[model samples]
Target: MNAVLRRHAGYYLPFLALAAVLAVFPLVASTNMVNIGVFALIYGIAAIGLSLLMGLAGQVSLGQAAFFAVGAYTHAILVTRYDVHGLVAAVTAVLAAMLVALLVGLPLLRLRGHFLALATLGLGIIVSVTVRELEYTGGTSGIFGIPKPEFGGRVYDSPREFFWLLVPFVVVGLLMARNLVGSRTGRALSAVNDSEVAAECLGVNTFLLRLKVFVLSAGYAGLAGVFYAYWLAVVSPEAAGFLLSVHFLLMVVLGGLGTVWGAITGAVVVEGLDEGMKALIPRIVPGATGEVQLIAFGVALVLVVILLPGGLAQLWEMAVSRLRRRGSAREPGELPTVAVREGPRDDVPGTGEVSLADLLAEADVPERGTVVLSVRGLTKRYGGVVAVDDVDLDVRAGEILALIGPNGAGKTTCFNMISGVLEPTAGTIEVLGSRVEGRAPHTVADLGATRTFQNLQVFGSSTVLGNVKVARHLRSRSGVVRGMLGLAAREEKEIERSAMASIAALGLAQDADRSVTDLPFGRQRQVEVARALALAPRLLLLDEPMAGLSGAERDELAELLRRARDAGVAVVLVEHDVDAVMALADRVAVLDDGRLIALGTPAEVRNDPAVVAAYLGTDDEADDIVRHAAQEVR
Candidate 1:
């Protein structure tokens, strides 16, 4: 409990203090100011939704106002025409809008960049036009006389009462927003935004996650729509149009893209400034408020984006951090690096060279020779060009199989086909007898064979622990809904612990929280391998895992591969380092011109005439082969 409190105290304490201020502000402020605050809070709820979709998910939505309109129309038509209670109508309205969002978002979410933005913008236009043409929607004018919430024969008719009611929407919305952005799914969203390939290989279903956030953001807009209806007692076509969507987008940008406080800050600042300017400008210089308000908004947004691109939330966080640091400062720290945590390493004296024999004793490991991955006639093509033609391979439960050849030998292509990174042109790929040839990369990962990239695919935006924890997606079943509600706390903690253990086991304990991007090239390569291992794959496909390591590091990798095989994980490596391959692999396959030129135990294949001619070649080519083989890990 203390750990939890200590971790979240920075967030909770300030929130409570702000809540106290908000709770009493209406009582002390003038009626007009109180009314402005209510509108700002309502706008804030929608802004938070936009922030999540755009800032975190890397989606651009321009249909927020349409969702808001859908909510308003649902409530207006239901409550005014059907005599439904206001709160029930509000709930129905939000649900109706979400339903619309669900139907629309399915197709829109698939489009990328400005394509998605334009599609969403089109949705807003369609909603506005449809509402304008419909009689039930009040055509041109919107449905009016929406009822206020009533309980015990008293309506919440006053601005103060409505303010109190809307306050919870803002508070609850922000809390939920914060909750989601900090959860496991939240990290997946960031991972998706940062690198979709990296996230998918870690087993994140990017398309599904994007669709979920899209609908949730729509629901938020819907809630705000219902609030607008109740507060104004009217719903108009203008409420569902382009300008309002632009305003919401402006709020998202002017504050900060993905921040909880920025969402509210943006909404409050934009709405308050516009309304305040309209009131003050007309009195000072009659009938020029709209133009002046636009000018102010343009200038303020430009400055915010140019100066503090993180928005007002970032500025606020910086100020708070500075004030807190003055009272309790620590020495300036260096970027993190991984070191082994003291345990068996300390007890065993001298580096207890972790070997295959020690790892073979682990309880979970299968016996030395179980079937893990089997590929039959695996072929891949690019148009008329055959990349990996009719290759057959097997990786047993406790053995390393190295696929090696010259640069254009299709070694990487064969690995890609097996890992589901590339769909095979013809033939079958399976893990333990289950076919995975046509499946997605994520599906293959979930099926227990995850691959690392030839180039590093670490989540550069996330911490080292975060990168590995994402690969543990299959290990935890607690999902987006449970995570947001904080119901998955126990399971999530276990997942974190497991990720940490994997990091520690890899001798990365000291750098468990470090950014992968901040690490050296060699360390980044290790992080890539560590992330693949963290998936707990039954078959691990490593594309040059020893790429940039030193000689000692390469030896460490050779031992690591042996250790992995001993632990009952099948290992498939595509490597250029011939010496390491010969040392590590139980069997070797050589490819040339997309054909298997040689396949046998290392000694058998090494002496094959086909391998010598195709791979080792003439004196100059053999010299090239020798140079490639001796290319040091680093």
Candidate 2:
């Protein structure tokens, strides 16, 4: 009860204060103050969209103002020139804005960071200039006398009347933003924002997810624009101006980039600042009132960025976490013990004392012997350097192949070429028998192939189970709309259950809810494998998976690989632990200087003079007998 009060205190207090304030301001405030409230509410709606795009998807779009302008003009033109009803015009404006967003986003969302920002800035400039020059859009003079929306024969022509009209939409918009961010779309966006390459390797189509967020954000801006048009009864080029775009961007950053409520809060703060600065600037510097307000906004933004870079929502999160820790923490050495439950398990025929093939027969793992992955003539080059050259490898179902080499032997480079991370200079990669040499990483993953990174890509901000669950993206069918509407609950529950099963298989069930970042390096590696395993791919590529594991952990992982292989999944093992590789791999391939040097059974590779001399080195104990014999014969 106490924790609930503490947690919701901040939430409820702000909501009630804002509601009470907005609810009463129109009743008692002057007309100018009421207009300011209207502006704040309207812009708050736009900021929510920005939050989803910039905050959630890690996309920085600066031309949301263009969307706003497009929407306002769409409604204004439709109603005045075409004899359309206000409701129809409003709906048309929203759909048009969405269409424009879709067209722009498909191309622009691919550009990252400032490049995207600049592209959108240019878009806003273009729209603003075009609107001002077009006679049909009313040129520099703008369009006026836009009709007021009439509902039940009531016309909201006055600011006070419009306030009542717009408040409901503002509420609905906030609710939708919350719902959208909590759904699968939000999950994919979060994964993409963390690392696009890593997310794609896990089967997330980064382009598609980012584009969806972009279009949705634009729709919000457009919706807000429609309302602005109706309220002012006019539309102007200034609505789509570069400065307005900058202003909207600043609000999203100022409040909190990733937080929905932060966007709304940021908008209110910006509007209040605008009004306050205007009123005070005249007294402080009458000669430059309007220009000084811009300066003041710049100064405020700089200070907030310098002092509170995470924005207000992050600040609130940090404070809440601290409070919760204090409230819920037990004294040191006085913690209660958690009881461990035990259940019966019927062992497979060969789990403890038989070969993996026997275990496969007993455990009923898949038995399809189809070739899962086939790589032929794979090669990659960088300028004058050859990274992987003419490499041909075949990975079939139900076997583990260890790729071993000394440092800088291009083992990872070969893996990259096959996994779609690097475009091969000349090669072909076929997964399930279709060429995918130059396909995107996500595309490769879609064809039943996925890989783990050597450096561990854990999405650290999420839970261990969360990390595993996100990897199930390709397996689950519940999408953005279904998730946001809460219709994907069954799929969500199934996903979590599957994640837990994966974790349990890897002996990580104890850390399911733990933040992966809090785990030790060894545990983190386990989580990475768990996430990969969740993909349920026919081919699994593991890079240095045993790098940080202890002797016992390595043995456990070896058994896990056996189970994976027995279940009809092909496993690619890249490791420095020769013993693990010899025990786990059915075949061994060695690379040296971007070329395959040895390919055979582990015993054959160990005994091959070329492999021993090139990889094991002249001083290696594996070649001691040959070296000694040669010296004696000499």
Tens-digit lDDT string for candidate 1 (158-184): 999888877766776787788888788
In model 2, residue pairs whose N, Cα or C atoms come closer than 3 Å (at least 3 residues apart or on different chains), thus clashing, are: none
Residue range 1-634, candidate 2, lDDT tens digits: 5654675476447555656666777899889888988998899888899999987898888898999999999999999889899899999999898899999888887788899999999889989999999999999978898988899889898889988788778766776677677677787778777767778988898888888788888889999999999988899999999888888888889898878889888888889888888787777887775778878867877888888888877788899999988887888888644322122122223323222233224223235566777888888889999888788888878989999988888888877877888889997889888788888999988877788888778786677877888887887887767765667755665566566667777788777777789899999999889888877777889999999999999989988898888788889989887767766788889988888888887767777787877877666575664444334323
The TM-score, computed over Cα atoms with residue i paired to residue i, of candidate 1 is 0.90
Q: Please identify model 1 stretches exceeding 4 Å from their true place.
A: 151-154, 279-289, 317-368, 617-634
Clashing pairs in 1: 338-511, 549-633, 549-634
Residue 263 accuracy (lDDT) in model 1: 83
Candidate 2: misplaced stretches above 4 Å?
1-31, 284-288, 334-368, 618-634
TM-score of each: 0.90, 0.90
